[model samples]
Target: MPQCREVPSRRRVPSTKITVPGPPADLVSRPRLLTVLDGASEAAMVFVGAPAGFGKTVLLAEWARSRDHEAVAWLSADAEDNDDRLFWSAVLEALGGCGRIPDGNPLRLLAVPDAPSTDLAFLGQVADALDELPEPVVLVLDGAQEITSPHPWQGLRALVRHQPAGLCLAVSSR
Candidate 1:
């Protein structure tokens, strides 16, 4: 068996990357948009796509704060996480660290420092576990445009195709 490489933790992921950021000080509340987001809670995925300076981040932050913090897991993607393992690791950490999933969830297996490569089967298992959850959990991936690589995207595509009722994926991209 090919040994799995240890995931480096030397570069600390910023807290803001995994935590829901507060809305900007000058944010103009958009009740119409927020209402749309409220209605999208039941959707398997919510996509916010626009050019730069469109306030996608501000709007998403606002909507995320409106919900129970425990129900939301946030990840701000950047150029650094363009790799498959790094991106999946961040996703696992974001979902696992959130207080929503109970301890010892199978999802935690991939979050460890020396876990094997994340493949389609693991993501499918993740979907199955999510389907069994009693409550809903929203995973917000912000700045998804930074991931130019197709490898991570293929995995995410698999996840989306097999998304569970309890998992609502929200993505923002330029």
Candidate 2:
């Protein structure tokens, strides 16, 4: 009889991506900046890249505030959560958070082998869900500069390219 060696167990820890931070209570409103963002809504991608203390969060939060009628999903990613699996996990979480993606949805079907085709299929499911919505959905990947890998960038590109109508991809990086 052959003896089997004991295999070590691996625990799946959830990603620590923070919730989108809110603007200060006393922060002043900027109507002009809001107007610019409203105008940019016609474009597919709205990227805000600037140095620290550039009011990126405040601006996005303001836009979110003004556009309360829209479906918005905000995700605050950190440097530590910069992996392919974690990146998609966070995206799913954020989308689910906004009620954009339903609970226990195509995410389960998307768990099949991680290939370009699977990745695309998963994104397609997301796009289909967004397409069914009566209002436009704005998915904000805030603090995205922390992720330096090309995988997330590629996925983001594919998502933006194939996103459903009335969906926007807003990336805020520093």
Best-fitting candidate, scored by TM-score: 1
TM-score of each: 0.86, 0.76
lDDT of 1 by residue, 1-174 (tens): 999976444234667689888767787999999999989979999999999999998889899898888888899999978766677777877887777787867765544232223554667777887887779899999999998978778777777887687799999999
With a 3 Å backbone cut-off (N, CA, C), the pairs that clash in candidate 2 are none
- The TM-score of predicted model 1 comes to 0.86
Clashing pairs in 1: none
Q: Rate the local accuracy (lDDT) of all candidates.
A: 0.79, 0.67
lDDT of 2 by residue, 28-116 (tens): 88889889888887677888888988888888877876776236777776764456666676666666556544455453234422433
